[model samples]
Target: MSRTVPYQPVLLRLLHSAIALLVFGSLITGFMVYDRYDKRFGTLNLPIIRDTQGIHGTIALAFLCLLPLFAIYCFHIGDRRLIQKESFKQLQEVGKPIWWISLQRFANSLLLVSATFAVITGRMMQEEWLPTGEFNHVWYIGHLIGWLLMFVSVAIHLLMSAKVGGLPLLLSIYNWKIRPEDMPKFWLRGFKLKPSTTFLFFFEAVVIGGIAIAFILPLIFTSPQ
Candidate 1:
């Protein structure tokens, strides 16, 4: 039989699946929530809240509920590099600057804080629920800023993930039951593969650039409600 490799953590698989769904849902609703504020983001062609409130609030609330669990998982995995700045000290000897770690921490902090505020504000804005003040006001201001922060944070997270053996670590979550044949290849430091040349390097840039561009375009020249 052929061989295979699993790169993510077993626990991460469960958490990532949960996180992915909730996050995607959260993003959808976020689009709706933001639609209420500034319906334009260049040529990205996004929809406003008026376009869809279907699950925006629900996912926002769910995300609020799910975050604590995720926090626990992050701690359980010994991956506190984001919150625990001291953990990154080991990388400093290789000419890697300390500032990078600080920046990573800041990015992580921004994502959590912004997401937290957005969730709180979102709950407050819900009409069918609590006795929150009208969401039609300046709360949009906070939400807009928070969303922007999240976008920036995710960008940094993806970049940093790659640098820190994030691919195998993330993939490891799937528990793919790595096979024996893949061992030699991995141990070879990819040297046995003809020291290949391929488009793999450009893959991430394309994906990240694509999403960033897509999000920004709708804000620019599109009334795509």
Candidate 2:
């Protein structure tokens, strides 16, 4: 008889599934909006959606609202696998190459930062600005940058996941074989504060706070009112 791989906790699977769906939806709709509105960077041959902005906005709102819950889960429970202190400690082994799991953690961290930046800058964008070809607006610029970062970050994340654990690990989150012990109720225990949790909090705050300040401060200083 073959041994079954360990099952992901119900809460973690649910949250990860929701986040993955939202991220993909946001990316598709956001690109459609960009293709329709801005061509300075060149345009794709994809079909132009007349209401891309509306679709994108709806997806963005959903993503923005749900992201906090996901963040909470990540900060509270997901940080253990995410922080990868063992990987960092391996840095001392000068001749040893970093493991795929370590690279995966780093990629995941970048994805979180990129997602937060995309959501913040996206919220600051107005529909009128995009339709009027007002691509030069500060928030729009930030949104564009965030979009690029998100695209790259997601690509890296997917690649790293594939390299680290292959299809089984990737599919584990979607598996329906949750054991009796893997119920959602027990997931909270993973959130206990370890030394690594502090590092995760600080990393997220810096990425999010730094981007917010960079874009928001300019508006505050330049406002005519």
TM-score of each: 0.56, 0.82
Off by over 4 Å in 1: 1-8, 40-43, 46-51, 76-79, 85-106, 126-136, 174-225
Q: For residues 120-164, write the lDDT of model 2, one tens digit per residue.
A: 677667678878777888788988898899889889888877766
Q: Report residue 87 deviation for candidate 1 (angstroms).
A: 5.8
The sequence of per-residue lDDT tens digits that candidate 1 reaches over residues 21-129 is 7867777567655455445553345543453555666676566666665544443342333445343464455545454555555555455555555554444343432
* Top of the candidates by TM-score: 2
Candidate 2 root-mean-square deviation in Å: 4.1
Backbone atom clashes (below 3 Å) for every candidate: 24, 0
**Winning candidate number (lDDT):** 2
Please list the Cα RMSD from the true structure of every candidate, rounded to 1 decimal place: 14.8, 4.1
